[model samples]
Target chain A: MTVTDNPRSYHYSDNFLDFTDEPARSRITKFEPGNAAREQTILRKLGINGWGRWQYFRTCFSDQWGESKQRPLSPRSQDRFFEALEKLRIPKDSKASVFLTDEGNLELVWLDDADEQVQIEFGPKDFEVYIEGSGIDDQYSYDRLDEIIDRFFAG
Target chain B: MSVSGTEDIARAICSDKWDAETGILSASLFKGAETSVSRLSITPLEDTWTVFRKNVEKPPERLLDRIGIINVQSLMDIGSNFEANPTRLSVEPDPLDGYPSHAIIPQKISRGLANKILKSLDIREEVK
Candidate 1:
């Protein structure tokens, strides 16, 4: 096995579940890096700030489940997620929103004008990023938080 | 999870079956390609029930009880076919919500659709 930092060395995901029971083609593009500032500017125009409101949680969790299950995100992981975004440096500009997992992990989803979606869920140990498009879905994992972020920017 | 809720949710998310050892409900939501699917899982805490979401896609699953809470230490061993994207939610014990937290993310549904689902699932308000 080869060990390297380059994405070219990394393998494309082989684990895909086609509940449709048919072949699916992935929809992802690797291109020249774009400016992060532009993506940030477009994000501002879109008006998304990772949903900092507690009311937002109240609305999403709704009182329906009604249990102590809903605890606030810890500053440690929460800050890590915020820090992870800066590391994401996704050159691709798209509509993005952030949400929390039940375990207080952070999730950020971005959509381009083409309607493709990229979802990232920050875990305590590592982070996962999945890109969705046309006929295919792909997933990638990294031991370090920034590792996945770099893949987001590169591919 | 009655004794171990870890495997319960894991199996439910992948296989849609209940595991007696783990105290998790069947709350898995898949949309678009596998990359875009959201997850919703539930576990009974000592006093309350915990629900986990990856991307908020659809209505909640039928709630059920499992054996017990699994050891968090052995969670990595549970093994999953898909990668855990940091952009979505993960289940855990906490007081604050994740980025957007439950009922958010994996947002392909229209606001009208989201509201409709919320209205349908809202236990606080009786659906007419």
Candidate 2:
């Protein structure tokens, strides 16, 4: 098959979810890159697990997501972020703030029981974890993502 | 104008930087990796970032626009933890392109400290 015809090149499946059934768009209007269908597709590709934060995450892919023309989210980083999310057991009740670094990587943050922020920045190959006001700072390959998640959420 | 630790500073945030789910700003907004000067841009509330802009029908709307207000003292408190070379962190005026209100936290901050500063943000409101 031609390089462009490769199925792996496509980011997301065409049919994932019916975002039309959800409530009308919220107040955020500055970052719309395309029509409603396109927006829904972007959200679906991001997966439905943490749907609440997906809307915010989807905008990171836009060219205008930053003020000074930050690089658009790279495909490598996108693949890494989506793959990593599948292994994380983010607390159902806890909210996590999402961000795209200057290097076009993904960074997820949430407050721990002590109200200190915990950051997980995912690069193309490896990810780094940093716990605020603590000494827990280190990097791990994608293979160890599951192990890290389990340790952090172990109850 | 000299920046003071007591004054409140406003940093313009793009829509993506403000998480609607958590109703807070992201730590990534404070990263200096892209900045060649090793400083993150901020402006005092008294002057605001818009002061640099010239005539426009709707000034704020044309901007990539949300403001996160954080106290300079709060920034200094967090910066103290990430002291580099034993030099204390402080905000200093760095006017650029006629933006006299422009100022910066003159330090290379870590993501952990950036997150701490993110939590210290006193206000996250849409600019009118």
Candidate 1 per-residue lDDT, tens place, A51-146, comes to 322224424433222122432343344445556655555434455555545444555556645666555655555555555553223333444555
Which of the numbered candidates is closest to the native, going by highest DockQ? 2
Assign candidate 2 its CAPRI class. Answer: acceptable
lDDT of 2 at A90: 56
lDDT of 2 by residue, B1-128 (tens): 44676776766665445655465466777765322111123434434534523311122332334556766777677777654322255667766675545566666766656666667765545355
RMSD of 2: 9.8
Report the poorest 10 consecutive residues by lDDT, candidate 1 chain B.
B30-39
Question: Which runs of model 1 end up more than 4 angstroms from their true locations?
Answer: A1-71, A90-93, A134-143, B1-128
lDDT of 2 by residue, A57-128 (tens): 554353433334555555456556666665555555555666667666767776666766667778878988
lDDT of each: 0.34, 0.56
lDDT of 1: 0.34
Stretches > 4 Å off in candidate 2? A1-65, A110-117, A131-135, A153-155, B1-7, B33-66, B71-74, B82-87, B124-128
lDDT tens readout by residue for model 1, B79-123: 221233212222332223542212212223221222122222212
Deviation in Å, model 2, residue A117 alpha carbon: 4.5
